[model samples]
Target: MSYRIRPAEQGDNEAILTLLQGTPQQGAVTLNFERQPDYFRGARVACEQPDVWVAEARDAPGKVGAVYNVGWRHVWVNGEVRPIRYAHDLRIAPECRNGMILHRLFRHLRKQLAEGEWMQTTVLQDNQASLATVASGRAGLPTYYPAGTIETSMLYTRQRMPRLPADIAIRQSGSADLPDIAALLKAQGQHKQFFPYWDVNRVHGDEYCYGLNASSFLLLRIGGELKGVLGFWDQKPIKQTRVLGYTRGMGMMRHLYNTHSVLRGGMRLPAPGGVLSYLSLHSVIVSNDDPELLRLLLDYAVAFFHGRYDALICGFFQQDRLAKVAERYRRRLLLSEHFLVSYDGDPRGTLDMNRPWYVEVARL
Candidate 1:
């Protein structure tokens, strides 16, 4: 009945995935073990190689009881770039939670971190058990501090909703367009606090392209000049759950506001164990400071995927350059949120909503 916690290695992928393929809904999330084609390529090649921890048992040897990824990032926070490590995909077998295994696994993880290195993680605000764990952080252990909430605006463009600006054209992007796409993302990255500092050279290489269900890009042009760019990602098959009661912790009014947004659209809101056939609308960047450019892109995306997907997901940290435009599509947007937390609190109070923050789609 003994278990050992150790760093996960290459051969452990299947075991790790088995743990992720939930026995049933463990909490609000149901992570997909079925990853998309080459989806992890960019994440695997991150500057700080991803590290994972697995719980191996002695009795039923080769059995994985739990797993998590201590993924790394280069982020801009408070006008300074710092290394940030994210604790992602934390999964523990339902049978294992009551034991002291959770504590021991985390304690082992603590030993791996170097001095002054902060590890960041996120949790659903309503996932009380995980939040309580973060709140009770042991002495000398890295405790995740809830900095602020990042809302993921999921829009279900089931039928066509017109808003496409006149005279703008959308075209498919190719390998020859990498430089243009990279440059656009970089320009937009500067506006968000937690946006990753992409190693563009590597990002432009072969690895990053084949990392999604579709490595597709769209260029929006006005009179032969590029005004905006958008990426189409089929985040489907690699799914996530919209566990219903996860919203129980929100204030009545906020919940009502979100519910109203959903009900008004008449689209079936995702349920706890459902495979969110989500299409990610990512790599959103624009020039000319025009909110209308975002409009054009959204319009084109709706037209492009009219019957191909159920919903489109897009998000930005509050006060991001796109936030203003996002508001313009208020009627079409529904609510979901992710947290941007740090192990070390922002002593400078800089990672506020007023300041920009970014969570790259690839990392999430």
Candidate 2:
């Protein structure tokens, strides 16, 4: 069967959602394609920008068989403002599993991003198909999760804050705090894709930030400057037995991103019920001299969450420095086996655990 790959149109929302739902592999991650109308709308709007592409079965007219959500961002790596195309969501319908779908998407995206640029994406360690997809491509060598422990930490109301020196203070962020938060994140060497340029605008524009149920965010300030930011959200603990239902028939069980796979093999840990939280110890930018400030900021963030939420879960990509600190707090390692797939470029480099990059936190 032939498929016509093109940009998604506004009219293709329902068809795209149906295609996503039909893919059993995506079902485990709680990616309720039914409720993501806005995300689809956003993607469609983004598709209008000439860089995004969608694949649809030609015979079925509007039925979107797959979506290749790609976009570019400016990165100031090593003092150069290089443009990097970041591949977000790459989904293919099970019926149309031809390898050529992704290959075509890559060729199209590469052509769109051809003017003096680079591309990059991260995949989980266990996703062999996606890992193979990217590794076998023309891109550079893919980076596997180097040996590093991913620590999970929970903050319940019962824990007490550790005594700290007098310079650091926790402040609630208002709309006025967005730009400063943006700057601090950029300064901490966080890639622009992690914290999209319009993230704050989207949050505050529709006052949708208030609608977030499981997540809460705050700014960490030291000496009255925005040193860093912390945010957390509650996630449904993936039930191991439930996940096995999907993986049982396969030769090699395919884990769903991070959340679902973490719960597999009875290794699942309990998550908080009321106001469960996932903490992002986002960028700690201190004066060139105050290196220890990062440690202090993290400690306080954990203590703050413990005082508020019932449990806290933080994601650590391989090679993240914060994972070392997470070890000291005795954070449980939840989902380290899963990988993310990016079609842009090689997946080497430090995974920034600080920013809200995980799929569960953002789209889930």
Clashing residue pairs, backbone N/CA/C < 3 A, model 1: 193-356, 193-357
- State which candidate has the highest TM-score: 1
For model 2, the superposed segments whose C-alpha errors exceed 4 Å read 24-35, 41-51, 80-82, 137-159, 175-203, 206-217, 231-292, 306-320, 330-364
Off by over 4 Å in 1: 23-48, 77-82, 137-141, 161-167, 199-209, 212-215, 237-274, 288-290, 319-321, 324-354
Name the 10 consecutive residues with the lowest summed lDDT in model 1. 30-39
Cα lDDT tens digits, model 1, 54-121, are 89997776788997777776776665667777777778888888887877877787677665456655
Query: What would the TM-scores of all predictions be?
Result: 0.76, 0.62
**Superposed Cα deviation of residue 172, candidate 2 (Å):** 1.6
Task: Give candidate 2's error at residue 185 in angstroms.
Answer: 4.3
RMSD per model, one decimal: 5.9, 8.1
